[model samples]
Target: MSPNGSPDVQAITRLVEEVKKCVEALALPDRRAALSSLRSAISVLEDPEEAAFAQIFQSPIYNFAIRMGVELGIFRKLLERNGTPVSAADLAAECAAEELLLVRIMRVLTAIGYAGESGEREYVASQLSKAMVVPYLEAFAVHSSEHSARAAIRAPEYFKLHGYKTPVDSRNCPLQFALETDLHFFDWIHRHPEKAKRFNVCMTGNKLRRREWFEWYPVAECLLKPFERRNRNDSAFLVDMGGGKGRHLEALMKSFPSTESHLVLQDLPGTISSLENLSSGIRPMSHDIFSPQPVVGALAYYTHFVLHDFTDERCRVFLRAVASAMTPGYSRLLLNEAVIPERGCPPVFATGDITMMLVLAGIQRSKRHWVELVESAGLRVVDVWVSPDDGDMEGVIEAEVAS
Candidate 1:
């Protein structure tokens, strides 16, 4: 084998000829029919659209039911009595609500497989429903409901008053609209300290649910491993630029304990101050990355679910600030954002992109668009790793300072 103790040239030539024959056969009429049959058989294995639509549309109903159940302490009540199937009338009596209203909501949940109906009026908690009984998951439902309410309340006013043409009018971003109308989400919640606490609890709940996905993060593991092995003395920092309340950092730390990293939870002053007593090992730093990132000397800077919140210009500014913080050779940047597929990929991210656009004048980027953004910020893309399960919903792009 060309002096490498492998297959020789003649053997390689013969193998290539055999492969060419196979390729030629794939083009033949009978082989084409076989290929078509194989594809049809594969499609029967899973109906993707049926699963996706159910997930996207029915999720809100399930979330709402969970929130209502938590509010009424239904799960806790059931668990106290060892998860016995209780009557709707009894549940309503306990919560001092109308039985009909409670049953209607329960019916929606039962249809979606969250709860189980026992005979005519009785209900039993399913495993999924039991999972929602946890304090964190309950709080998450509340938080999601709060955001939904905020969006609903503002949508009509935003459309009529501001001459807002669509949900994603560039003039009125979600952050700007929330700030203008609600005077910032947390700011309003700050007045009610209990609500603020619930908000944090809800944020933490989302982290708990999705942190497992990080283990499957291909590029994050690949890029961070080198630093963990090489740099023994200095703690390599992962500056989570715009990391909301250090939830992502907490998740990352849980997943990668050896990767010595500190979270720089950057946000608005009001948002930062509210999260003063978050927890140990999380240094909540207040700095607007859109202005100019103050803290430097980070090993690998990270931005997750942040870039899609801003317009392209603002995204450029954000990236430039990250670039400015980096020392040429050492620091690397990691972007955990969706890389919108060109054509053949699923429509989940595309639909998400539309939601972002409608809600906050945000747009998801394609790979080429991301490349442009990276290059524009004086950084060059090293590699991109897409999750096999998630397609491009949570892609990791490793970038370094451009030479």
Candidate 2:
């Protein structure tokens, strides 16, 4: 130990003071920015075991603790009271969990910085905690804990039985092995309505103020009719294949309300039927991507975070369908899926890839993979729009039908 207890301790003290100053100076730091800085700082300052291995080992405990907070309405209660400190007894009464047990759980919550210990026996939600209570997050946590975790926990068993060679079909993957059923991921979700809602929420989260292809892509330039011919627009400009909830189309309609080009949204019949207060701006159609493109000759066929749910062969089926219907010289295909870097991926993407591997044999493909896949489907790459600063994961890939 150095003179001041320990060098690491002193370093932490200095870092904490510096962080305090930085945060204090800012009127309001972005949530993601704050999280990024905190995570980077912790990685360097904290013990490797505690930061890495220990946390990995104890991750389930933390995940479940967060789940319990969501399920028990603890965060809702605290938020309702507007961050006012409340005793364990009051929370216990509100949630129906025993006070003593709640106290133990609250200790875990506070330890994780989700809940702040306002007084000796009271608690309040932190800003991060409030953000975590979104319906999207609740659904995600439950999905990970109950549905995804079941398959994830049994990933080793699947590996042991089937070997590590992947590129397998999603229907016959680890999820099937874990559940002892051969249904596809969507079919399984259909059987469980509640879990389907959760799945929907998670998908909705993707379209809700999150990073998307349109952020860097020229949406207006591609979709909008040239101002000179505004009165004579005929065909659909874009079709969002398997686009859930029609959120993307609706958002775009708002952005280009004056443009006369038709916007189309295509998905399953059930998805189309469930959409509420759907904007009149988008032409809704019940069509599967695997089937022939029903809305033909679209200037752009957009697919975001959709292709990863299937095997390579299934992706080929979807792409071939689009290629067959697209006008050779006019139509363009825009892929918003991840083109994972060759070097290394962020931990979140790594974990996501592994989880997808367990359930769907899904891959975040590299640029070469994207090129090969598109060419195999009779399409040629036009441009790949990437923005590393905004974490676009190799961004959007624009392609056109092969001549």
Task: State, as a TM-score between 0 and 1, how close model 1 is to the true structure.
Answer: 0.65
Task: Compute each candidate's TM-score over C-alphas.
Answer: 0.65, 0.87
How far out, in Å, is residue 121 in model 1?
Answer: 1.4
Tens-digit lDDT track for model 2 on 96-122?
A: 999998998888889888788998769
Q: What local lDDT does model 2 show for residue 163?
A: 74
lDDT tens digits by residue: candidate 1, 147-208? 54456545666567757564433545453454465344445567788878887676555334
RMSD score of candidate 1 (Å): 13.2
Cα lDDT for residue 403, model 1? 85
Global lDDT of each model? Answer: 0.69, 0.78
